[model samples]
Target: MTDLHFLPGCRIEEITRPDANSLHICAEARRRSGRCPDCGEPSDAVHSRTVRHPADLPCLGREVRLELWLRRLYCRNPACSRRTFVERLPGLIAPRAQRTDRLATAHGRVGVFLGGEAGARMLTQIGMPTSGDTVLRLVRRLPLPRRPAPQVLGVDDWARRKGRTYGTILVDLERHRVVDVLPDRSAATLADWLRGHRGIRTIARDRSTEYARGIGLGAPQAVQVADRWHLLLNLRQMVERWLAGVHGRLRRLPPTVGQPAGPARRTGAFPRSQGERVASADSRERKKALYEEVRRRHAASEPLLTISQRMRLARGTVRKYAQAESFPERAVQAPAHSILDPYLAHLEARLAAGCENARALWRELRDIGFPGTSMQVRRWLGQRRSAPAKTTPRRYREAQPAPVPPDAHAGAPALPSPRQLALYLTRPRDGLTNEERSAIGRLERDPDAAAVAVLVRRFADLVRGSCIGGNAVVRAPIATFKRWLIDAQNSSVSAVATFAAGLQQDAAAVKAALTTPWSSGQTEGQVNKLKLLKRQTFGRAKFDLLRRRVLLAA
Candidate 1:
């Protein structure tokens, strides 16, 4: 067959169609006479004729098969011990490798897209033949740059095999990239990583004692900042606990006593409000309906507890509700003006009169027939003391004189009214309810709201805090929240208090989100794209090559 020259010193010769699926090539190597093929010594000795063997090579389509014949030679050196040696091939792939280096590389790249076995199928479809393992091997052989440990570190744990094993991921804060993954989430393992890496000025980590211990042992100098996300989560749990407790305590109170207004009484426990009643009523209704259905069987001589067991409702509740024809109506009313209000004016007067004694106020309020308990008065006094200083009214006149009334003059523009300014400050968002709007107006006038506002103001303070120094702004609020949580007792204020606590602790991380914005949006998008690539590859492609393509594409 005639040879086709592809380039200088390289030719494609004798392209035999092995099958519709594979291409076979028989080509001669570039020949140059210098040393004996049998030995490296400069001896010229020609031995047997060429032989043919199967090999793989890069081709346009299908699978390209290479059939090569090379010469054998004898040593011409008189003193040489060797009789013959086969000629060594150049520009060929590793020994025993089925595919050419180029084809193997292509397979690896496609494998990452196809993933494992899927990639193998894809390569077959493309006419570049390969298997999943071949694609994996190709990926493993590729060189990757050795990265140094990061300066500022972030350590997070993920399930290796959920419920059995876990892995720790270490990220470089400065580079905003993953640096390494640890096999275990133990303190010893984490400490080892910290010890191996140097110059880590800070660590953002969860509230695990193991990590804290590790940081203490390995990178003592590095400031360990509680991750804002975890702090918020912890605060959420605290809120849930308090909310549940509040509901439970209210349950023991008389049904007729409605929710108390003003600072809620600690022991003059109020009845459930409409919102709480609705939830409780719904739960009761669900249970009652189940019990009635089950009780019919019970009435027909079924065991007493059997119906309860079948329905999964408490035996006592089932017995009580089963006798009734239907679910009972919810009895809830608007919370009343708290019994603490009568003492509010007196408490404020005492504060105005320079009395900071909470215990003293409790006694004074108790003597005035305050239906509520001492704990309630004490809490109210505490809130009053912490409230901000009231703002004095400021008078201002417009620079321009008021225009004449529109109907009075020949041509006059109307002047803006003071009510507009009042509305702007006091009004809630347009669609807000009357109660919500009133709350806003109260917040505008009262010092208590201002105190709450101070904590709310911490949100913005944290944003500016980042620019001030080396992440000190975040630490301050986190510390404050910790203090509040430790001392918190009143369940009424606990929800908002915990929310404040969460904000304080997580302020830094959330601000980091606002400023740097490390959202999972892009990562999630890539994961979705990866799913497609895997489907295309048919689950046969290698992971290393898939990873390479994903990273390179990024």
Candidate 2:
């Protein structure tokens, strides 16, 4: 048979099968090394020979092990401090390594792609048995490849231990890869990192004062661009606060003198889970006690902070409780997802076909693949059946048309939450549904809300590169944004005024965000990736490993 040349520059001599899944091959190095590693002088004197066993890539579905016969050479140069050195096996394995170069490379790639435990399992499944720790070590030892400096950088902060410690994530926006991760979110750390890497012409970041200060100090020449998504998000939060303050004004208009009062409003009396009911009752009792104590303290003319200290509650909580109002209700928890979610379409089809019996629906669901109980189906059906039914209005006898009652349409849509309202306001008018349009029209009737809506729409037009008038698309200029900011400030809306002030402080960045297209969206995507890596390791991995995985994987 021909010589086995699986490994170049090495001759395979004896092959032994220790087990059905193992192959041990004894081999000797072919080349005679004569170079002294330290002195760089040629030495051919052989000192001794030794056997080094190192794992190699699997061959033909069997684990391959190489028993390499290596030789030690004496350094012939007397002037060199080194006495003896091991013969180097070029392209095969590194000194003191337990695996061949190619095998280590393969394992490193595996670790980078799948991470520790998952990668270990994958290697074992592929006939290469190795520990997770070994895989991670191999990955850690791999050298990082050099990259050219990016001109456009994106900066953001991610929580290391949320609400306690945070780190900065810098990304090359043009290449869409993370550049580096700083240990802390401090301005000094970020500024130091920025000062090290020059040639950054533009930086896209959020409205973080610390990051802004860092950029100003480190790279004053670089143009800063505020992220549009963050700007819109900030605007939404302001709008929500404004809406919360004026929520009472959003109530339905009172009925006219001759108009008949509508039917008593249907309240949700459906049975809730017992555990949830108990929890909610307990929470309500706690809030009531806290509110009573807060009111008692306020009646005695105690300061907010003093009350908070006495009650061991936050000052904000004390303030909220002290305000003259009834106990605030706890937000209702949304119902959890049921097994019926997969069969919702089928159930809807059956319901449209006049199948209203809960038992029948449950039987049909079980006939397919639903593993849920009949009670869930009953609860769902009860909700559907109990919904307020729409009724036609009776014709009025008066000569002039009677004013329509606020609840004239019995199927009037439920009022949406502030978040939903913000969504409707920010989205294009043409894309809105009939109900959403009606909601917007109702909201516009309030002067404050109307002013905020106008500003929001103008901001949306600027961001989306479209003009607001008659679908005549044109990119909104910085001048229009400035004018809008001035309008918001003068509108007497506290939330809008605060937002406008923030924009004015970062006026240049905000202008660049509107006029220029640079954004920190790519950097945010990288932060998401970092979060995934952190989760994969169960958050036990150190920052070094996480940093390596993020950079190498990218």
Model 1: ten consecutive residues of lowest lDDT? 407-416
Model 1: per-residue lDDT, tens digit, 379-463? 5554445432233133312122223222221221111122221232222256544433433343334343334333333433343
Q: Which stretches of candidate 1 lie over 4 Å from their true place?
A: 1-10, 18-22, 31-58, 71-91, 137-144, 173-177, 248-554
TM-score of 1: 0.48
lDDT of 2 by residue, 1-554 (tens): 11433777777878888999978999887775657889988777889988999998887788888899877889988899999987887798888999999899899989987888999999998878899999999999888867899899999999888878888899998888888888788889988888998999999999999999999999899999899888878877777656644644553422123223333323223455557767867987988888898999999999999999978998757865765345544322223445666777787788788777888899999999889899878866755643322331344222232222233324444345556778888888999866567667777777878888998888776766621333232344777887888898887777788888888999988877776667888898999998888788887888898888888877
Error of 1 at 491 (Å): 9.8
RMSD of 1: 22.0
The lDDT values for all models are: 0.52, 0.77
